[model samples]
Target: WLAKITLVENQVLLKYFVISASLAGIIFLKGAEGRICKTFSAISRLSNY
Candidate 1:
């Protein structure tokens, strides 16, 4: 059970990190900031829950 929980947490952390890294790409892109931020926030909320 402990290992399983840790794995899930790791997955969430990795996903969170990737989304954060995506910010740089989003900044460079033409006009996807809104969508990217929306997805990022949604995923963050899910991770918190």
Candidate 2:
């Protein structure tokens, strides 16, 4: 019974970890995309000038 409880706890912890990791990955990707867009716009402006 105790082993079963531990197994369940491990599963829950794994689920939480996976969720948090994915959220972090999404945020990182969005940040990188914004940076790239900003850089592109800056380059465009420079070229225009």
Candidate 3:
């Protein structure tokens, strides 16, 4: 019974870690996308000149 409880706890911890990691990844990707969009806009403006 003790082992079963430990197993359940470990699963919960693993799920928490996975969710946090996914959120971090999404934030990082969004940051990178913003930078890329800014760069593209700058390049387009320069070409227009």
Give one digit per residue, the lDDT tens place, for model 3 in 1-49: 7566787798998999999999999999999999999999999999999
Clashing pairs in 3: none
- lDDT of model 1 at residue 47? 100
lDDT of 1 by residue, 1-49 (tens): 6666787798999999999889867777746777789989999999999
* Clash count list over all predictions: 0, 0, 0
| Worst ten in a row by lDDT for model 2 | 1-10
The candidate that achieves the highest TM-score relative to the unseen native structure: 2
Error (Å) of candidate 2 at residue 27 is 0.7
Model 2, 1-49: lDDT tens digits are 7666787798999999999999999999999999999999999999999
- Between candidates 2 and 3, the TM-score winner: 2
TM-scores of the candidates are 0.41, 0.64, 0.63
What is residue 2's positional error in candidate 1, in angstroms? 13
What's the lDDT for candidate 2?
A: 0.94
Q: Model 3 off-target regions past 4 Å?
A: 1-5, 40-49
